[model samples]
Target: MITDPELDGEWDTAERAEPAEPLAPRERAAAAAARPWLWALGGVVVASAVWAGGLYALGDRLAAPTVAYRATKNLCADFKAQSLSGITGDLRKRPVNKEVSHPAVDAAACVMNNVPDSPGDFYVYVNTELHKKADPATEFDVPSVDDLANVGDLRTEEVPDLGERAVMTSWAGEQGLNLKVLDGGAVFNLRVFATTFSEKGGRPATDSNAVQAAMVQDVRELMAALRK
Candidate 1:
């Protein structure tokens, strides 16, 4: 029995306090290992943020190419396709044409139904796009087929001395040609289709070689006309 009440309370408090249990060896080791991983994860997050910020700052500069192409509404009247006139006859007074101008892109298209009176089917199409916002080089040469046009057997050939890159496409048993040219940020496409069943030889109105040559020649003139 203690005489002092204060001394007795102190003893009681000491008895009530149990020593805290130490963590298991495995738990301690796991905690130690996780500390480094947590730090690494934090570092990766910070680095990712910095990289994203940098990319956002350089987005426009990286995506846009240096080009001097201007949008024109007179693309239809500008291109005459004179070289093709011999095969498809003279151009009509009115050809279907469209033009669109936007901050990101400018587009112009012309479709001429040549030799309407004396031909079975004849068409000449020209389209030009000025990309003022993004580069079109990546997907330019990608292979694509038009199922609706029966273009499964379409073949492509490279044309030199035209632009940055040029490609001509033609299909088997088809008297037509598709030519695409890429110059800086400008994309140009020219297509010609002619099918006339002649009674004399039972052949198409235009041969493959003739169509190709005429398309190439007319496309050069078309490009020059648009540039002017």
Candidate 2:
């Protein structure tokens, strides 16, 4: 029953507390210094993860093309050695079209090499003119794998017995030639095809028939080399 206002004022004054000051810049800097490695550790972890992912993707893209090229190169070397074995002539090594060098060839080789007695049957086709002239009617035929049936009498020729599962085909052209080899499993079958056109009678001359015959003969000979 003492005066109510006087009692309330005293109670509030007695319960009041002072507010704390904010941290100073110096204090904050010291705190960060105490755990400096924490920030560096986080940055390193992030960078490492990013680098690893990038490498994985790059490897995948390169794997196929690299294999295809190597297989093609091997084919070229093998063909050059055997085709020009007896003949003493300078065989110019030139890069073939990228289309003929597909990534599938490498992927196929990877699988075929693992199999038992798997002969790498990589295929390549080239079109170049012979050193000598060829009759138009007697020229070779360039047949797509799908058009094997159109090869006519050439298809009936006995496929040379390559000791391993491999065959090579070469076709002659007016300006260039065509060559290919089949090895390993059918899946890894790499085919390299190229064509060159030479002018005859003021026009581009191509003997598809002669090209086909040359391909057959080249393949047959390649098989023989593989046997040795």
Candidate 3:
């Protein structure tokens, strides 16, 4: 390598500076004025990108379920006190069932119980889950119903002419009845857990045929209520 030996081998000497010509007064004013306009143009470009991206984000949110939709549906709000009194069979003395909205599932549940604190015996629990699909409102049976079927006691099958789709499940020992009805884009489930307790701390068996007929009629009435 050829070496330069200027001032004891200092190779990268700084270049001499050219004197900057000072701007005229009018030119300085024009340059200052242009900076704000340049910043404003950049702001507009950023805002346009944000606005377009927001619309695409809104489209994604539109597919998610909303609590307002479930709370205002037929089951939650349509039935008056007198109507529920009939369906629940003289539980009218009970306070009005409050609408409970579940935002996560985009669903809601309205319940009335003979005993307020008790989840057992003589309660009507109506649950609704909304979906985008038109068919197959529900994919699986309620866990209790499936348990009975697994043990050879419950029969779960699609019952035509009930609604858009429905399943009737009845337990062999007849301790409880679970009926699921799928109407339109919502899946509605009615669970009735009613059993008389014998003096010996054992649950008395119910009339299986009577319970089945009554559950069938409940679904029928639910369909009628939705129509109204």
Candidate 4:
């Protein structure tokens, strides 16, 4: 019934529509096969990245303990003297169990036991006296060379207390620093006994390398304070 050419073209739906070509079976199958593998590969990459990141984070936390041990070892090497004569007079006398005159020094002495024990059992002690001369206070005298040499028990093998798997020994030293290590609690099994003398007063010095090491170990601040 349409006479106009424009009207006739509009009325023919088939002329305006284009037919879609069917996808090849091979193409369709290839696309279907690739999708799952692509998703799986992406998942594996993500998992690997997460695992690597966790290890890096763990390593950072362990760094502090490692650094602390190294610092203590260095401190031992630095202040080691051939003879204990410098503080010998003060070391001979017995310690008076009193509150430490220098609390900071006492705290440092306590921390020595927390250091990891290796090679042999480690111990520390502090002895102190109160005097009006010096404000900061003084370290106890070191033992004489002869006395230190004579004392064989300074080594782990010589001391029976160290034989126990979890035995720690600590007492006040000639000055005001004392500490020791025993095998027990996570950290508490280790003990630190610190004494402080007035800069001019305290116990006489002794010649004991074990004692000297104890004093130096406490006051040395190579490592930061440990919580556990």
Best by TM-score: 1
Better of 1 and 4 by TM-score: 1
- The segments of candidate 1 whose C-alpha lies over 4 angstroms from its true place after superposition are 1-61, 117-120, 143-151, 197-206
What count of clashes does model 4 give? 45
> How does model 4 score by TM-score?
0.27
Top lDDT prediction, candidate number: 1
**Per-model C-alpha RMSD:** 15.9, 21.2, 16.1, 20.5
In model 2, which runs have C-alpha deviations exceeding 4 angstroms?
A: 1-73, 81-91, 95-204
The per-model lDDT (C-alpha) reads 0.75, 0.36, 0.56, 0.33
- Model 4 Cα lDDT, one tens digit per residue, 64-161: 22111111112223323222313422221222122333422222112222123332122233322222222221121233343355354332211233
**Cα shift from native, residue 84, model 1 (Å):** 0.7
User: Distance from true position, residue 211, model 1, in Å?
Assistant: 1.4
lDDT of 1 by residue, 48-107 (tens): 999999999988667777665667777778778787766666665567789998887899
Instruction: Give the range of the ten consecutive residues with the poorest summed lDDT in model 2.
Output: 107-116
TM-score of each: 0.66, 0.25, 0.47, 0.27
Question: Which portions of model 3 show Cα errors greater than 4 Å?
Answer: 1-89, 95-105, 115-121, 133-153, 197-206
Return whichever of 1 and 4 wins on lDDT.
1
